[model samples]
Target chain A: MSTNPANHSTPVNTAAGKLAVGWALVGVPLAYGVYETLTRVAALFG
Target chain B: MGFLDRERTIAPAGFNRWLVPPAALAVHLCIGQAYATSVYKTALVKHFGASLTEIGLIFSIAIVMLGLSAAIMGTWVDRNGPRKAMFTSAMFWTGGFLIGSLGIFTHQLWLVYLGYGVVGGIGLGIGYISPVSTLIKWFPDRPGLATGMAIMGFGGGALIASPVSTALLKAYDPNSGAQGWVASGDAVGKLFLTLAVAYLVYMLFGAFTIKVPADGWRPAGFDPATVKAAKLVTTENVSARNAVKTPQFWLVWVALFCNVTAGIGILEQAAPMIQDFFRTSDGASAVSAAVAAGFVGLLSIGNMAGRFAWSATSDITGRKRIYMLYLGVGAVLYTVLALAGSSTTILYVALAFLIISFYGGGFATVPAYLRDLFGTFQVGAIHGRLLTAWSAAGVAGPLIVNAFLDAQGKPGQLTAASYQPALLTMVALLVVGFVANLLVKPVSARFHEPRPDRERPHEPAMEA
Candidate 1:
């Protein structure tokens, strides 16, 4: 999938690409955090 | 130019990035000390003859307030910037300790709660988010590592506080009735005063040291769109208000709540749980019990280390892959903990530490992830809203673990073995998290709105 061309200029090899990669790196653990949180709530309901 | 503008315009060369983490560490390490509340549980119970419920409330109130304060202060931090936020955080945090010292001296439980839980919790919330958004903007090329470095301090904060609190408690030895036998009240008061002074100094360092990145400062040779195209996550900018309205927000909420609840089951009661497990069959002594408390501190070390190491590692491996490792491997480790049933101390401790690391890693990595999905536009505010998950986990994790323990008839009794039910319940939670992680499809294209002309020159809509 291509990123919206309007929001970003220059290709993936540009500074924007590095910034996106940086954000994704942080996002991994973030996704887990959300997972961790929801399951804890589920435990209470059960 | 204003300090914010001046700071942003001048990028330091070489060792500049090093300053941000330590500044962040000062606050995190201080508030992370909350992890050591278990160290004081016995003190509160012994001194005030407080009930288990009352003791739990102290910590719970603090955590709940932490979330509330963060939600309120986040927008202010965005508008005013980290310096003002950190300055305010330092004042409240240090002042809370001072006030708490008075509460302990006067034997007023309500005062203690007000001081530490409400006042201090606000400090924690402000201090916690102060550096996060700025760090992401500053190190846009390495958001994961940059934020991880600062956040790891928060995880480690408890590691530092646990040993310090233990040492101070021993030094005071209120029972000795000697020169050092300060009344428990006096000792607690003095401790708070000392911590108050120290935190003020440390937090001031953070406030003064913080700097935002200049506008239009992209990393050398990096393209944003190409990277967004490769990742299945969102690249759209969504306001915190709009972000909460989407399904994606709730999905992430579920995921965090599960992971934290599973970890806190072991964390909130680590020392007593270990001792009880050991004593039921073998009858460990008081000294051994004290040693178990140290294990809690060790877990803090693991938690802190993982926040930095794993999150930073995610920068290279991809966030999805690291999370897969956390949920998949975490489930296996938790299962081993359940089956092991305290047979080998080594297995129990090792497994607990690993799980805590994943827990801490989850926290350290999420803001960056939010930035990825929602864009940096109102990420600090969005992140604050997301922290409601932590507040929920704070209540849920302890309730599940403690309720099960309470149902089993308190730790020292013969029926304490019934904690196996809670452990099994945690394992089930992990499985649910694993499913949620799997269900997380990339952010939908519908969520990506067109950028305003002010943000960029005319361009086509991005693909998903």
Candidate 2:
């Protein structure tokens, strides 16, 4: 049903590329937060 | 036509564009509840026999974690999709409440911190960013209003949470000489459990309803290339890494930090400031603690209203213009608040409301501005990085307000008039913010020029 050539270049692929980069940026911070939370919880149990 | 036939005729991959804003609003409203944490502060402190510093710590922890979590989860929203992020947010948010309920029942401080501060904080971070990048993509032409509509919900969330939490605590009161609830831990537990269940239902609605538009979607008549040409704003489409290295990024960071630090000083101790003001002035001590609660509620309304009104205004006037208004007019209001002192209650409420509105406007307008400068490419991630400013303000704002108040308190006079000194300090911060806003120039054309020599084979052509 799609007729426009513009649809072909909608940058959906670009979205994926951006997403990969975004995830990499956040990955370290997320891991650190998880570690901090886990350690705090562990101390509670210990 | 059959229902299945009708469904097939609609865009198969793309969401109904109309549905996206409402879905964004739903998530924001639920997460916005974090602003209402102060409503529980006095009760928690009284019940637990904790000091003001300890009680304040709980909120500080939640806020610090909110910034940290947002910075971390922003990338996840970009990669995994909003659906996954929203779902995860709902679970953690609900679980935090449940755990908090248990903590209240058991009389455990650490449990409460873990439940609300860490778990719920992560939920806030994830939920906050879920709709932002998607909304910017959906409405490239009017990115300000699109992001604003969702964020406005967040600013207003406190408006709903405050009065509602107050009523619930009242209803659940054990009447056994307990200030708010029965002194028993069980009563407190039940109250938190009820709040958890309600929030879970609301947040689930948001999670299920959210969807990103199909790839390459734009408005019917809009041309992407035309947009790139029209605004000399940040449209370079740099990766987050490259964005951080640019001078424009640090300028934005300074602007956000100054704006937030100026606003939060007033917000953190609003109730005490009002009470002291009234007590020292007229002999009418009849306003009571509940009236102060109502004042906070009213401020929440202003906060929510400003998010929508000012941000929507940015669409017409431009983001830079609105920020100037927030800083310039906000500075004037702070001056009036300081000089007028407690002489007029009407003036106090009006001026406070104005300041709070600017505070809320700063938050709403920033995402649209980010989109203008950076393009939608990894904007949510960039916005997350920018929130480190908020973390700094969280400490700086409270420190400025409290330190001033403490210095005044040391005289042992301890009246509402003591707040005058703090108000003056806030005025000075706003003046600094005003100068920073003026210094913000559009990114230089040289910075926008793509070095073809350095371009990766896969990188899109830099917008000229």
Candidate 3:
């Protein structure tokens, strides 16, 4: 059973990369939405 | 078709569990667009030459469809994996937008109802539950946190879509952003087309990326026994069919219905109610319209934040104890608001924020509670059936508030005293929910599947 080191690392690396990008895809928009909402929310006191 | 199968979606060893939350978020955020229809509502009313009631029916129909479809398709969603369910949801959702756009272009209201209301509503129902079971399975140790992150996206979805929809309308018609401006029907049609295409891509990404945990997978160093150690938490499996037969199901239903009802009492009337509460002797409101709008926005923040924060907190506090806070303390908060809310703005805002957060918390916490009571065997389906409570509350909450207000005076002219009756009614409802929560006990043995152990490992090839 020949297990290449690079092949073993590839799935792990891909999984890590996917995690970051996936969170960013949802997180960036949610952050923007929150920022906009906060700006309006600030007006409640102002 | 093969790619979307439950067997195909089973995760390989070492797949990152963190990736699944975003996948759930993608579908939720897209379906969350349902909340942003108000941005273009006036335009639709103007274009269709319909009454406000008629225009609003579009939203009403969609909500009804959401509850109905979720109840109908829940078991189906559980049988299939998240991948197929998410994909089907994406297709129906985008298809609704496309059909709705066509209706707008052709000037037909029924088509709009069929497209966005019935079809899009089904999308909402399926999409809402699609990722929940998967997220629960992935993080059985922290089911509250896992489900909270996904459900919070549903709340946050409106936040993103409202601004984006406004921007799209502004881009289409520069005057749409001006004071009291309504975009043209053509612009809204174009907006629908754009959203359908964009959401299709986004939801497709979510569907493809989502993977179920491999059979018997558990997070590192996590013990399943610890979860069942709590009094209410169970290691038993109850099929969705049997779950409905149990009194525990209806008790949770009452708790959810009351929580949602009280929250809607504040949400539905936040803008006008704030102004009404602070109105001067001669009918002038000390709170400006802009400030009232901001107050509504603040409540929205409370609503969204509560969904995530309170739900995650349940992971530590335990689900039943959290519901005690939501329903029991919720009743107390309503009492104070009804009694003294008129005295100060700060008191009113603070109390309303807390109540609404409990409302959101109730929503986010129920799935985990169901997981505790019913087990994960059909938690998604049970949760789906549970959402019918939301639909009932939606109608009842507004009716209760409005009926009392109508007895007092017209809109834009009422006072805080006028709202006291309704507010007190909510307090009573919350008490009922609190009692229901108190009465909740374990499901009887007969409801459990006949298997030796309820926490059966996933057999991907097994039929329901």
lDDT tens digits by residue: candidate 2, B1-464:
13212122233453345566766766777777787776577667777778868767766777788789878777666776666777788888778888877777777878888998888888888888877887888888778788877888787566556556666766676574555443345555666788778777766665555566666777888877765654535656655555666666777677777778877877777666677666634544424556665566556666767887888898778777788888888888888887785777778878888889888888888888877777777788878777778888989988887787787874334565677677777777777777776766665444443545664445433442
Model 1 reproduces a share of the real contacts of 0.00
Model 3 alpha-carbon miss at residue B71, Å: 0.6
Q: State which candidate, 1 or 3, has the greater lDDT.
A: 3
Q: Write the per-residue lDDT of candidate 3 for residues B1-464, one digit (tens) a residue.
A: 69899999998877889999999999998998887788899999999999988998888888888888999999999999899999999999999999999999999999999999999999999999999999999999999998889888888888999889989988988676578788999999999999999999999999999999988899999999898788888887889988888899999999999999999999989999988889888988889888887897788778888988999999999988899999889999999998899899999999999998898888888899999999998999999999999989988999999999999999877999999999999999999999999899988777777675454344322234
Q: Which CAPRI level is candidate 3?
A: medium
lDDT, candidate 1, residue A21? Answer: 44
Candidate 1 chain B: 10-residue stretch with minimal lDDT: B455-464
Question: What is the two-chain DockQ of model 1?
Answer: 0.03
Q: What is the TM-score of each candidate against the true structure?
A: 0.81, 0.80, 0.96
| Top lDDT model | 3
Show pairs that collide, candidate 2.
Answer: A10-B216, B234-B373, B276-B416, B277-B416
Docking class of 1: incorrect
The candidates score, on chain A by TM-score, as follows: 0.52, 0.49, 0.75
Evaluated at residue B65, the lDDT of candidate 1 is: 83
- Candidate 2 residue lDDT tens string, A1-46: 2447677545455545544543333233223433433343332123
